[model samples]
Target: MTFSDVVEAVKSLSTDEKIEIQLLLQQYLREERREEIYQNFRAAQAELENGSLKFSSNIDELRKLIQE
Candidate 1:
């Protein structure tokens, strides 16, 4: 089904059901975000181990690195 179809179905739900669905969606989004963060952390760790990542002690150094 399309997004519009899903929207119409949600609109037909009772108030309580809508609230439950909202909570479930929030939980699912949070879990997705957490997993994304974990994956990013693992990638950064691997880059560091391979000597391909640089560490900066200040904003100036970070800016310089980004410019390159």
Candidate 2:
């Protein structure tokens, strides 16, 4: 169906049903994004643990990189 038809169908739902659907969608997406962020953080932590991560101790170089 087209976007307008989907919207019209949603508009026909009761207020409580619409709210519940919206909450469910929000919760589902939030959980998905949270999982993604957690996975990325875990990968970075592993890199640090394996001595594959690098850091610059020079303040000037850090500042230049941040600006870029």
Identify the leading candidate in terms of lDDT: 1
Off by over 4 Å in 1: none
Residue 4 in candidate 2, Cα distance off native in Å: 5.2
Give the TM-score of each candidate: 0.90, 0.64
Least accurate stretch of 10 residues (summed lDDT) in model 2? 59-68
Best by TM-score: 1
Clash-forming residue pairs, model 2 = none
Show the lowest summed lDDT stretch of 10 residues, model 1.
48-57
lDDT of each: 0.98, 0.92
> What residue pairs clash in candidate 1, if any at all?
none
Cα-based lDDT at residue 52, candidate 2: 75
Count of backbone clashes for each model? 0, 0
